[model samples]
Target: MLKTLYKGFILSYLLITISCTTNQNSSDLIQAIDNRQTDKALRIIDQLDNLNEQDSLGLSPMHWAAKRALPQITKALIKKGCNLNITDVHGYTPLNYAIKADNAEIINLMLKNQAVVYKNGLSNLSDGPFVDWTEKGLYAYYLKHDSISSKSFLLGKFINQNTRYFKGWNGDTTTYTITDNKIPAWEFKTQEPIFVLGDIHGQYDRMVKNLQAHGVIDKHLKWSWGKGHLVFVGDIFDRGNKVTEALWLIYKLEQEADKTGGKVHMSFGNHELMVLNKDNRYIANDYKNLCNNLGLEYNTLFHSNSVLGEWLRSKNSMTKINDILFVHGGISQKQIDSGMSTQEINELVRQYLISGSSPKNQDKLNQILKSFGPFWYRGYFMDRSQYKKITEQELISILEALKVSRVVVGHTENDELSALYNGKVIDVNIPLAEDSIPNQALLIKYGKFFRLTEDGNKTLLN
Candidate 1:
């Protein structure tokens, strides 16, 4: 009886010793892997008395290595005969852990070793989450499998049309073919030339009333008067609540005129140039929020530095209709003396329009801005009192130098309606105040002799 009892004691001691040894090895191996000590983890795994021992976290050293993305350690454990399909508390096998880590290297190694791709040794189609897993996960898996082909497709898609990637700032070379299917031919010249006025700062509701009194807008929003040809001097952006509505109506009219046998000519205004030039310092208080809402990065839009600025630089300063030279601002003697041809002027305008942010030609841009042009020269023409004071001799000399009979401008804020100067120049700064009167636009009708009309009120000025 004593011999049998001693033998049982020895057997129990041996079993406990073996269990403690396995547990200690598993704990040390998992710790090394988790800490990213790849070299130490490999050494610990190799010395393991039992290769299949599970850690306190229920992960084999192999699973820990794969989860931590330690590919070298994972390979060493696999060679030691660690079970690749052994799952943890979360039921994530070594392969699943690798996928979650996004480690393509370890995943390929496991696949090459015939590790299971389908979960629980079952086909993925049998499970619901497996569909999502396979789509996102399997796509990445295949991409890793055939990297060359997948990358090629990605490159091709980047170059596809309708993508914004290629449509970057080049120059005038970037041509936009007139895609508006409603374009009318030049054969549709109206008997009366249209006069489009540009940016009216504030001066709202009053501008509408003036146009209505002039018979431009009837009881309906229809453009009834001034024949079919419509001219809009630009700006139309700052200092008005109905700016968007006004621009929308005008834009609609432009489209309508294009479809019909009519014409619409728009000139660049100083305010438009100001907005384009990022003269935010001069922008009205009401327009600041609207500008932000429209994502108008003025610096990027108008500074001659960018592509758009280059295009703006190329726009014509003014258009000639018979005897009158209608300009946004007014021209100086220097421009006329420069002997620039109409085509050259048009090209310069194109450059101005295209140069996006800051002017590429800084000196030239400054020269143009400082000269008596659309963007500059406000003191001479925009100031009505100044215009009224200038002698006829000075006016005739300037007009003669430019080879024009008369000048029509819209820069000054004329409170007494429109001003007729020396029977040659017309200032149409339709006043905004309630006390102001004769809010009007000068209409020039082309007959054998030119007939000048204020609003619809026709009069002979010659």
Candidate 2:
């Protein structure tokens, strides 16, 4: 009996020792995977048989490899029969990591092993890193395909799958025929006037109020006033709780107008470009929250490839109707003298507007910025005399070359209502402050001369 008991004790001891050793080896392999030591991880994985050993964080070696984006290590672990469906602490499976990392080879391997694509798991809100990886993977997949239809489909899928937190404004779905001619026939009619709306800064309530006052919106949010040829002078975002709502509403209106032979002309604004560049960090928290609610990481929806950003980039800096020139900011003489045609200037504006935070080429970007700066200048407008002081007759020469009686702009905020400068330019930034009398927007009727007045009243220019 004594001998038997001693033998039993020895067997228990051996079993414990083996278990400890196995656990230690598994931990070492996990550490290798975590450190992205792909070869070492592979070698360690090869020594294991069960492949079910969990790391300190309870992640399997395969999960570790996938999180680290070590494709080779993942492949080796797969060869060792690592479960492709094994999820980490955050509920992200190995395939999730592979997709997020843009590791197509590893993704293919996991998919071949029957990895799931859409699984309802624990929320990834706290797992910022993993969420980032996932977005990157989706973006990469779209990039790889590179077809407009494919891209649109993939983006819709991504939004549908992820962005359920906030209400999305789907622009009016009506398809409008693009007028193939130079200018639409409706633009020439004097009786049908076009109303130019200044920067809206996401004040949706104010926008609705102004539009309603101008007979643009009815009580039911329907278009009822003017010819519907509303020129929105950009800066539709930042500084308000309703930017998304405003954008969606405007997008719908734009589409509606287009369908009815009306139009919504937009000029690129600096704030839109600032957000596009990600330089001005003081973003509206509501907008940020909207992105988070949509399951998009911060900066994800406003990046270089963002739909809004791309659309802004494609807009013309200025529009010429008859003898009048409409630009968000006035252009300088140098742009005209560079032997650039109107089409070339428009293309240049597009390039500057689209080149986000870190431009692909610095020197090329600088050249573009210098030329596009005229239509994007704010400081120069603060001191008109400084234009001559800095550029030394260059500004005047450019203005003369453009040859319009007056350049209409909306960048400088004027407290004294509207300010006419040099008898050649107009600054129509309406002050929306409570202490000040409400200012007005300038409306130039197609066949009639220029006029300015308060929101509800009109005064003809003599």
**For model 1, what is the error of residue 164's alpha carbon versus the real structure, in angstroms, after optimal superposition?**
18
Question: Top model by lDDT, which number?
Answer: 2
Off by over 4 Å in 1: 1-190, 193-199, 202-206, 217-220, 225-227, 290-315, 341-343, 356-364, 379-391, 417-421, 433-438, 446-462
Total backbone clashes of model 1? 43
Q: Supply the global lDDT for candidate 1.
A: 0.51
Report backbone clashes per prediction: 43, 2
Off by over 4 Å in 2: 1-29, 37-191, 286-299, 352-368, 378-386, 389-400, 416-419, 431-439, 446-455
1-462 per-residue lDDT for model 1 (tens digits): 999999999999998997786677677778878899877777777778566667666787777777899989878877877788776777656776776777767865674464543222211111000000121121111011112221100000112223212321212122111112221222223466554453455455655564566556665555565345655555554555444335435544554455655555555667666666566555444344322322233233234532233333434556666566666666655555556543445445555555532555554455455535444555444344323334567677778866677776666655533435555666555544334355455566653222233446654444
Worst 10 residues of 1 by lDDT: 124-133
Query: How far is 126's C-alpha from truth in model 1 (Å)?
Result: 53
Q: So what's the TM-score on candidate 1?
A: 0.49
**CA-only RMSD, every prediction:** 18.4, 10.6
| Candidate 2 global lDDT | 0.55
Error of 2 at 110 (Å): 17
Cα lDDT computed for each candidate against the true fold: 0.51, 0.55
**Residue 132 local lDDT, model 1:** 9
